[model samples]
Target: MSNDQPLKGQIIIFTGTPKSEDVFELVEQLGGTPISLPLIQVSEWIEPTDEQRLMTCPTYDWLIFTSQSAVESFGLKMKRFGVSPDAITSQIAAIGTRTAAALTKIGLTVQFIPTVFSADVFVQEFKPTENETRRLLFLRGSIAGVTIREELPFDVDEWTVYSTEKAVHNIESLKNLVQTEKSSTLLFASPSAVNVFSEEIAPFTGWDTYKIGAIGHVTEQALIEKGAHVDVIPSTYTLKDLVLELIK
Candidate 1:
């Protein structure tokens, strides 16, 4: 234990396939030895059928993009089909601030951004009153879960821009780490990540020493339901806040 470290040699477990190493570096800066036990993995991909459908669509009244990956995946398919990104006239609806940045990077302006990031919040807060044609197109992942299930009314053309693959490396690493002293803190960003952790990481019973910290209610609820011992959660959803709370 160092006398100058804020985390004071705390062991931490990161549970999820991180998009980049920025978070890891930040963890190190906070004086925590992060255990790389990402529980769930996400890959960028699109279905052939969905790509074809999108290429064939005449036009859309609105285009909904929920994640950065959605924008990238769709961009790939559009490039493969020789479609111009500028040709799409439908105003883009971004789910979050990061997603809005992604759309802007591709030279598209966001016409709608809901108060919240979830699809349910997006649907409730979005007002289609300006346009008479209630048509929309959703660009999202294959395993986006049911976030958008009841969000749209009747039917909206959903373009499968990407598919989520369960990354097995996190669990494999977790199992190996569990063999040693469990001093790391398991951080779960989502409920799915928690489920995968509970199923993949061998049961600890009374021998486990890792503290679980879930980012949200959904994730916290999932962990408790699966009998995991959760330690902390911040009022905000950002990773920076989560880590900062742990530091405090």
Candidate 2:
């Protein structure tokens, strides 16, 4: 193996849909073969009430976004409803840097981001400007946790902008890869993806055969709960960071 290619001959399988192709290219640049075996699929799931809420999103004091999918779905909804970015007067808060970037792509400025990407930490650190009515709107996926809504002291309302479902079609392909590969690294980005893999693939391939890389502490905890040994977890909760940590 060349000195520049730290991941030479390594097969790294991404278990979630990477937000950008740069993550894949980075692995290839480092002399690793990157495989996409997405275990979870995300799609827009907007209801009439959700649309109404989104149309009047400016009325809220703060807008909270935790995932890029939510931001994408929200951007689509804004286009559908003819809601301009200039129409929104509410300040935005994102859980992660990627989420903040997505919100920025849609012409919204993010005013706050938690030190940690997790919602539990977000609630503790995020502070909104003092107002008489501290009403916040949380745009989230269908299966997202209630930590932000339940823990925040403000009057927080939630809108399900997206839905997450297991990508069962990839299971057979993942099984084949696991069976054929002598050694591989599996990267997990979300707890939902971990749950799906734990339920469908782990029973067939078992956990010990592969090295696990989790994007964040939440995913690491999920893997640990499923009796999987995590080999790498980056200090930052991003795919690029996870891949960099893997090479190290």
Candidate 3:
């Protein structure tokens, strides 16, 4: 292998979708083959009342976003309802850098971000201005936990803007890949994706047979709980950071 191609002959599989072109390009740049074996799919899931609530989102004191999918779904809702970014008077808080970037891409300014990306860290670190009736709205996915809503000491409302489901259709593709690539590395970005892979794929292709990479602690914990040994976890929770760790 050439000195520039540190990851030559390595096959890195990403178990989430829609696939990120940036991640794929990064892996290829390092002389690694990037594969997208999507185990979870996300889509917008808006209700009739959600439209009304989103239209009046400016009334809230703070808007919390935990994932990029939530931010994308929120942007879609704003476009659909004709809600202009200039009309938003509420301060925005994102869980991590990627979520913050997604919000900023839609012309919304983020006022706060936790030192850590996890919700548990966010709850402990984020402190809104003290008010008698501070209202916080969390734009979340259907499978998200209640940490933000239950832990925050404010009147927090949640809008399930997106839903995630197992991408079972890709199971055969995963099996095929596992059969062919004995030394491939599997990277998981979310606990949901880990759960899906653990349930459907792990039984067929033993968990310990491949090197595993988790984007964050939550996903690492999920893999550990499922009897899978995680090989790499980046200090920073991002795809680029995770890929860098893998090459190192």
Model 2's alpha-carbon lDDT is 0.90
Error of 1 at 102 (Å): 2.5
Q: Which residue segments of model 1 deviate by more than 4 Å?
A: 1-4, 56-58, 130-133, 179-181, 202-208
* Candidate 3 runs further than 4 Å off: none
In angstroms, how far off is 54's CA in candidate 2? Answer: 1.7
Task: Estimate, for each residue in 1-248, the C-alpha lDDT of model 2 and write its tens digit.
Answer: 78799888989999998888999999999999999999999999967776688777888888999999999999999999889999999989999999999999999999999987889899999876578247889998999998998898888888889999999899899989987996789999999999998899889889998788998898899999999999999998899999999877
91 Cα displacement, candidate 2 (Å): 0.3
Instruction: For model 1, name the residue pairs that clash.
Output: 16-38, 16-39
Of candidate 2, the 10-residue stretch with the lowest lDDT total is: 126-135
Tens-digit lDDT track of model 1 for 1-248:
56456765677777765555777777888788876666655555655475567655447788889777788777776677777767777878888777787778777788988765656677787777646346777776877756664566534777776776667755666777756745667778777777776766647433246676776666778888887777888776556667777866
State the lDDT at 32 in candidate 2: 93
User: Tens digits of per-residue lDDT for model 3 on 10-82?
Assistant: 8999897633499899889999999998899999997888678887798888999999999899989899988
Best-performing candidate as measured by lDDT: 2
TM-score of 3: 0.96
After superposition on all C-alphas, the RMSD of every candidate to the true structure, in Å, is 2.9, 1.2, 1.4
**TM-score leaderboard ranking:** 2, 3, 1
**By descending lDDT, how would the candidates be arranged?**
2, 3, 1
Cα lDDT for residue 115, candidate 3: 85
